[model samples]
Target: MPSIQKPLTKRAWVRLPSGRRLNLLDPTPFDFEADDLALGAARTVRWGGHSVWEWPLSVAQHSLTVLAIGEAEAPRPLTAAQKLAFLLHDASECLGVCFDPISPLKPFLGEGYRQLDQALQTAVHRRFGLPADLPPAWKKPIKTADKRAAAAEAIFVAGWSLAECREALGIRAAPLSADPLTPIYGGLPWEPWPARIAAERFGAALAGLAGSMP
Candidate 1:
């Protein structure tokens, strides 16, 4: 069970596996169950050049790829714990509504969303059996992978012509490479891959780490 302080009414509300039913209009909050909220959030968060039909690059997909990149990009091997951290880094957005850099809701979200975002992040890490905090070195590279995925998405999945993406999004067209098993823009409604493919890829990377242990 996890909770966030409802800013408008000043009460605590439990966010269940499903992401629904908060104390938006109530004074005293109650618990609600809605796991699909995270999945919906994953689909809703859009970057520039959005399309209802085109399979946009999802946070879930980016997260999975980041984990793959982390394993490949690590100077030596990465611990299981490190790999898990990369996989779950954006899990917070699963709780709060995902917003793009230019989305208007971002500024309007204010303090309440920020607090809820932090709470969900911590909860997701704990749920995955990862430490609540991530290492400083892992932070920059994971973010680089995130951006790299975004760059790829902007060019490939989001239907932005390379020149249009470069001029509008300021994202350069970079070479795309990753673990062979990791899916690249596998399918639309991208959240499914996390519970499906990402879990396996993460496990394989961790196994590799263990084998390299001295």
Candidate 2:
């Protein structure tokens, strides 16, 4: 069957590496591949490229760090859906941008930005057999894990002192000194990784999570 035609407006079409044009205004689960999400995320810089490392931290790496942090803090092992959520939390940011918009700037971008993100997120969730929204049981732990990930990244990669993280970044909780991924990924703990390596590692995890889904 012929795929649905692109939206009338030219701006709606975003061409992917596989030559599939995703309609950002109305995305579908089949619009992209896991590899596409992984590569896009690996290239999307976090902390606005302000990291102390040679290369800026990528969302790919941050997602994994968040997973590791979540595992360390969880009362029990995270469900596969929850783990998938953590890995794909920032997947939408990778669609057409190379940088994550800082929290302060998201408001100015208006509801359009918010809707686009939600649309893509919904598609991402359905694509992997997850609920359109995160389960309530999963939210609190993921939020805390994400914050902890930020705290760690701020201090270790972005050159922010712990005090600065508290006073300036408003992360009151303490950051983790040891990264859970160190044993698996084998790098300087919490340091930013090159985009290529980040993508490769992220791809491995993405495949595992997606395959685990019923």
Clashes of each: 4, 0
Error of 1 at 150 (Å): 0.6
Candidate maximizing lDDT: 2
- The TM-score values for the models, in the order shown, are 0.61, 0.92
lDDT per residue for candidate 1 within 54-97, as digits (tens), equals: 34445555666667666776888877677767766676564434
What is the TM-score of candidate 1? 0.61
TM-score of 2: 0.92
- Can you give the lDDT of residue 193 in candidate 2? 87
Error of 1 at 206 (Å): 12
Query: Cα lDDT of all candidates, in order?
Result: 0.54, 0.85
**Worst-scoring 10-residue span by lDDT in model 1:** 25-34
**Cα displacement (Å) at residue 4, model 1:** 26
